[model samples]
Target: MTGAPRIALITGATQGLGLALAEGLAQRLAPDDTVYLTGRDLDRVNHAVESLPGGGARVRGELLDVADPHAAGRLAGRLAARHGGVDVVFGNAVMRVGPDDDPREIVTEYAEVNNFGTTRLLRAFAPLLRDGGRLVVVASSLGTLHYLAPILHDRFDGATSLDEVDAQVAAWRDAVADGSARGGPWPGFVNIPSKIGQVAAVRAFARERRGHDLAHGVLVAAVCPGMMNTPTSAEWWDVRGAPGPAEAAVPLLDLALGPVDPLHYGRLVRNGKVLPWSPYRDDSA
Candidate 1:
């Protein structure tokens, strides 16, 4: 609380987990710290900010549609001019499709937001990270290697650049379009690969920052907050008794604002632990 004021940004923060994250940060950060809660809708964004504790004094609302292709960069540029640099960023915007959704449609929609938008956010905000800043991509356990076919394991695990990860995503889209992806190799749940691409992007980005000269060095990771009983989750699965967004925000806030761990860098983390990249590992625990 005695350190310099911090600047944090949370995408898709109008509601659900993103909103909860914004609220948690607003409450935990120093009084002077600024937390930007962003969403595609200007009205909702404003409403979300106005609803936070402290009369939303430290929280600001911004319009951000991750799918816009240029929105992230624009926001980052404006933030850079005002704050010089950012301390933490949560790439929390995403799109989810249900089981009954068309495979081709799912690929198109998820790629725009969940997959490509993730890469866009990283590319724009990463350079603005302060010395010890953290960039967290809100991925899921379904993104783990174990959920993907063995054929794709090496491709995702060995990817060292965003372009490489993108190639895999493009391939999946093509497979879905041609009707060859209907069976085993890829999971029936199309969203799995989108999340995989997200985690892969995090690992790839982390590797790129290996030798940078920063105070504590920047930490980037893909985090799975687990299932929450939010409207988004309720849309796909029966999360009747699942934890709420506020409960799920605890670990995410810890990972973002707590001490930085080099081991957690560039890895998939959940509940404060790093998830294995190997598909064969028993990750159920």
Candidate 2:
């Protein structure tokens, strides 16, 4: 609040990993630091902030539904005006519908909430980060393991420029809308490609940021929190050997708060360690 001890923003903070990360960050914040917890429901956001251990005086709540680009843009403007800029931004909001939903619907919703939502947040908040600040997105390992289309996968894996990645995501979105983004192993499982798209975005952002001559430095990357056991992930927890949200939040907080390292830029991480971007598949069922 006084000097720049660092300010953090986390979306989807009403529950699950987002709330857990808020709690962890609150515990680690200096007296001058602040962390904003956000969600679609204002009451739930306030409750989450109040529920933190000792009711973290430095933690506050706000209404933020990353699904809405206009809302995201407005929030970014407000934060910039109030705090000058933020030190860290965590694009953590995501949506996973019933496992039996139609593939088309799932693809559309996931793209809206998981992929495009993150892009909106980044575009809005990336400039607000202090030169040496960090931007982390809560991504998934499923992204690396799954492919929406083999051709798209090749382009994503071998992208020579960020524009190429952006174009590919656009193409995939168009395909999804046209009912051509089907027949993949992750059909009706939108979380996979959604996260994969996020990973690519991370890479693109990192490259674009590093290429520019800026004041300090900005490290942007995504972290796979593993398969967290929460309401959204209820269907696969038992079979995936998922950990509790609190347990999963540790690595995410670590990455968000850790010092900047060049190697970490554009990498997909788990438990504070960088994970190789590979397309290894698990065909067993």
Candidate 3:
């Protein structure tokens, strides 16, 4: 891996969109560039690496459970020591809880894996990024600030700090615990809040990167694939006729492989376009 042209780390690459992105990257990989693919299961991770486009010879697999922050830090440390650093870090792993589950359990699971776990990876891997690096977060269209409850919209819109974001997340967890989240606008929507928190995290990362000299030239942004047909949403995709993982990977590939545009920094992108956050753009119905 020494003297590689470029290095990239992609999590949750065992299946679905993560696998698609890995394949896409592999198809266009420069001879010296290397892409690290990670997943919870070692067998699955190795299989994914082998199955990637162009034989995936350049892809390396690692075991990673995003929910384990300590392990994530260790992985980051290893990457730092091995390659000296990386140029891109993609946060693609996610977990969701349905409305039928206990409210507290649903909120807790989603917050832990999606929100807190993602935060941990971002924080741990950020210092390992070389100058002019990029961080691409796989977010969802439904996670936009526009889809948040009115009160939450106000709070998140005004959140200028990670502490504020954590406070708001804590409040939401409390509401779920006490049953107040049941009839609320985003009631039982496990992925919504988690995704929203991811978007907010992108903003926070971009803001904080500017203050740290080690993190200079690093750009943070999130992307939504526009309702792709994957294992998790087979029924919805069956009826909606949405594109499959291979096709949906195009826009995300553009974000993952292209040069960073200053205007798009810290923004949410969909269909290869930057999506503005406005209540008027709310189409969650």
Candidate 4:
């Protein structure tokens, strides 16, 4: 926005990988360019903004809850008013309803944050994105089932609003709604269906938004930030432990702000490899 060549907004930029990303980006960006760091906690956001290493890129803080229905549009308007428009919008912030939360609750959480929070921002900000601009979604490897088995596409790909996600969940509401997403899970696998659904949503967004093709004309890619050390997954893996968010931010950074092509939209990519999450890997072992 503001006729600038580059301006970025990273949500959930306070702690964990998000903070690391803000730090990393600050090191590389110029002083003129700004990176708006947002988070639910105002203190954390302020800290993130103030903590930006004195350098080329400037830092700003905003308190936001991605799960809020009105937050996305408000942010979009803020960007429009403050900076004319935006060139880069990274939809990285997400909050899960947790393992203990019922399926309905989880669906609600996902719809609130991931589906609505991120998707709505993407849609509202679509106007601000420069013609050749980049949009990076810091999804998880959990968003893909290729590494596990038996992938499935969401029947809800056409949904673009909360009403739609609710309707879709209602459809499953009547069914036996197995969180496993299939008859059962493969050994060492958890939440397979939800992950697959995420990938499907990314693909669906691309298909519906970009001529019903794959990875076309836009630099859209959903990266599986493999098992990062974050609280989101603590419900199941706490005992086993996991890599810290700082550690997992490497690949994520690449997916978000690194150099890439514009036609790779809707590509469920990892590192440089295209993961196989379709055709439903039947190996249940």
Candidate 5:
């Protein structure tokens, strides 16, 4: 509404927070604007597109599996060809690992989808951002630096490039395979490191982009939409009375379509406020 006809993309948008994000964007965008809702399942993607408010005129669904190393790149190519550039991108696809899940499988899956998936999106789509575009990576509160041991803080915070972040993730994956990750500074919960790597990738990408010569400059933020009563949440914990995805999507919609602030750039944000790297108390609650 505030800008020209925009093009937006939301990955893993067939259900939960991703679907809510797609709906919000579709409602707020101009009638001529296009909102792409991507998921791995074609039927689910079609269902999500049909479920939107406007009879699927401007909303288009595409199959996307972020875990596939080449999928994001291919999607980016198609979108770039069609729209020239994108106005907004929400890296919302994620994977959750349960306690009963195999540690080795968790390591491989989380590394592919959660950690490097963020990297893949950044690499593929960041360059295609139109002037005054926005890129929001939907991370988690567990991604805060304080969630891990103090000794591990520098690895994320000191990362000034995406390659550095990738190196850290690779190192962690190797440690997990070699059985040395148990007593290391890493958190016992595998999801924490994966989310941290996501936030780190966004930060590193933003920092690297600062030196580039793009007009109006793109805005990038890693967002923690907080806990919600989604299917994904139900897989890991009890969400008896938690807010639904639509309610949780309010702030994310604001971050995506609302005004941008330079101060919030490259920072982990929640409810329109910047989340501290290390707070005195648990800020997640």
Candidate 6:
């Protein structure tokens, strides 16, 4: 709190992957660096921040629920006002439609939080980010590819063509319209394509905003994080089912807080490297 430290703001830092990532940064940050841990539960977030590596990492706790009804923009604005500029902001909370929820309700709420919530968070902080500042989002590989379910949970990838996924979405709408939306999880194949579409939208959002000569360019990429055992999945961490579930956080941290390069902007990356997806830098791919 003395010297102006480098700042990183992370949502969903109360537990699981978010906590792990925060810990990693705490271990590495210099005295002047501050980590802003945000979440819906104040007590939980405070505990998480307190429990972090206390060596000298100046940890600050901020409470925010990105999925709260119409609150994301306001929340982001508050962060911008408080910090002046965030060196890194990681959007990582999640809301998914599942068998326990109405299918239509699920998609609507999920999109609101995952897509719209993420967009608003970034836009709110655009002014607060220094030139060359970074933004990282926690996305599932399911948000990119149609992988088989591990008998523990379900998810979708959003990297494929929107047309194909749109067909499924239309069908889901039809089913829900007739009051026949099935109770089972949406098929993996169907979900992956839809998720990819969402990711694509995020990328486009970055592109449109790039026209402005903002501080440090934005690297708005989502990651799979490989279904680790976290609250989002109800703490279901069967290695066979949620294999490498928390493994993606380290790479996610790197993508957000590590050095920036000209090649990785708006790219969907994992494992400390930007994937060749979306032709982010592959001109002829």
The sequence of per-residue lDDT tens digits that candidate 5 reaches over residues 57-151 is 28999999998989999999999999788999999988767768876666877788888888999999988888878889999888888788888
**What TM-score do all the candidates reach, one by one?**
0.92, 0.86, 0.87, 0.75, 0.92, 0.72
Which of the numbered candidates is closest to the native, going by highest lDDT? 1
Find the 10 residues in a row with the least total lDDT in model 4. 181-190
Candidate 6 has an lDDT of: 0.60
For model 6, residues 57-115, the per-residue Cα lDDT tens digits are: 68888788876755656766676677666677777766645435655545655555565
Q: Which prediction has more favorable lDDT, 1 or 5?
A: 1
Off by over 4 Å in 6: 1-4, 96-105, 145-194, 211-218, 227-247, 276-285
Off by over 4 Å in 4: 1-5, 96-107, 145-193, 209-217, 231-235, 238-243, 280-285
Q: Which pairs of residues have clashing backbones in candidate 5?
A: none
Model 2 lDDT tens row, 1-285:
225667889998888888888888888777678899999998899889888886432898989988886988999899888989888788889876676776565666667788778888888888888866778889888667344556556757766554666576667766766777665333445666667778888876776776551336677888888877676677655625678888888878777776666667777887767776765642111
Candidate rank order under TM-score: 1, 5, 3, 2, 4, 6
Name the regions of candidate 3 deviating beyond 4 angstroms.
1-4, 53-57, 98-103, 183-186, 210-217, 236-240, 280-285
> Which 10-residue span in candidate 2 carries the lowest summed lDDT?
276-285
- 1-285 in candidate 4: lDDT tens per residue? 224646778888887777877776666667788778888889888877887678867888887788887887898898888877765666778765555666543555554666556566666776676544556676666655444443223444444543444444444433323444334433223244345445555555555556522222335556665676566667667624567766666666665565554444665666655565444553111
Candidate 3 residue-wise lDDT at 148: 74
Per-model RMSD to reference: 2.5, 4.3, 3.7, 5.3, 2.9, 6.4
TM-score of 1: 0.92
